[model samples]
Target: MTNPLPIPPVTLGAINMEAEDPQALAAFWAEVTGGTPAVSGDHVYMPAAHDGGFAMFFQPMTGPRPDRAASHLDLTVPWGSRVATVDRLLDRGATHLWDVLEEYEHVQWTTLADPEGNAFCVAEHPPVAGH
Candidate 1:
């Protein structure tokens, strides 16, 4: 086999989302993530909880939303909080798509779409090894 090239030293900075109204979308995410939103020109930004944490950026949308998003955010909540968390999100304008609980042993998740129809999931899982 050919020698593998050295891997680049890089880290994910932020996740950019497209929205019809950047400010409104940013507000929704801000509420969901408890992150403060800031507006800069036509774009809006929601800084991560702390440095090196995951951040989000909202930008003006130029095309229609896809029927199936190729990727989506998978948010994990404390154990035994998934139901309540899903309900809260629904109250905050999220649409419940479906749920998977019995499909896999010890695995459960609820799929939802934000106000802008961007899909995401809420689940009860262990925290990442590091913040």
Candidate 2:
């Protein structure tokens, strides 16, 4: 066999984000992307087609809600997918934040937040080529 590489052994195979309610978030994510949920004990485990995606353990938290200073994600709509995408997201319970207008006739973005208050923006206007 070829000599082993000098890199350290990979100790982790997946990542689990700790949400206030794992099952709720897990179901929401699954509904949005058609992902499957696997439960074991008190954790809601999910695996996606990508690597390092086989785990996301959700544990319970008590008292007032905790702070998530830097937990979020961004999704994009390349060009012709803006209208339908935004509408679909709205139907799924995402709340409107703001609509960034470039001009009366143009929009740069429309911001929205998920049910749990994670903010993300959808580009209402896509960049043109050769500009």
**Predicted model with the maximum TM-score:** 1
Which ten contiguous residues of candidate 1 have the minimum total lDDT? 122-131
Q: What is the TM-score of candidate 2? A: 0.60
Model 1 TM-score (2 dp):
0.83
lDDT of 1: 0.86
What are the runs in model 2 whose C-alpha is more than 4 Å off? 1-16, 49-57, 62-68, 101-108, 123-131
Q: What C-alpha lDDT, on a 0 to 100 scale, does residue 124 get in candidate 2?
A: 55
Cα deviation of 64, candidate 1, in Å: 2.5
- Candidate RMSDs in order: 3.6, 6.5
lDDT of each: 0.86, 0.64
Task: Write model 2 residue lDDT over 1-131, tens digit each, in one string.
Answer: 77787878876454455567777867766654456878776677776635433444455554555555365454455666766877887898778887766654434667777677667677755566686
RMSD of 2: 6.5
- Predicted candidate 1 versus true structure: per-residue lDDT over 1-131, tens digit per residue: 77699878898788999999999988888867888988999999888976546789999988987788899998877878999989988998899999988876655899999998999998886355575
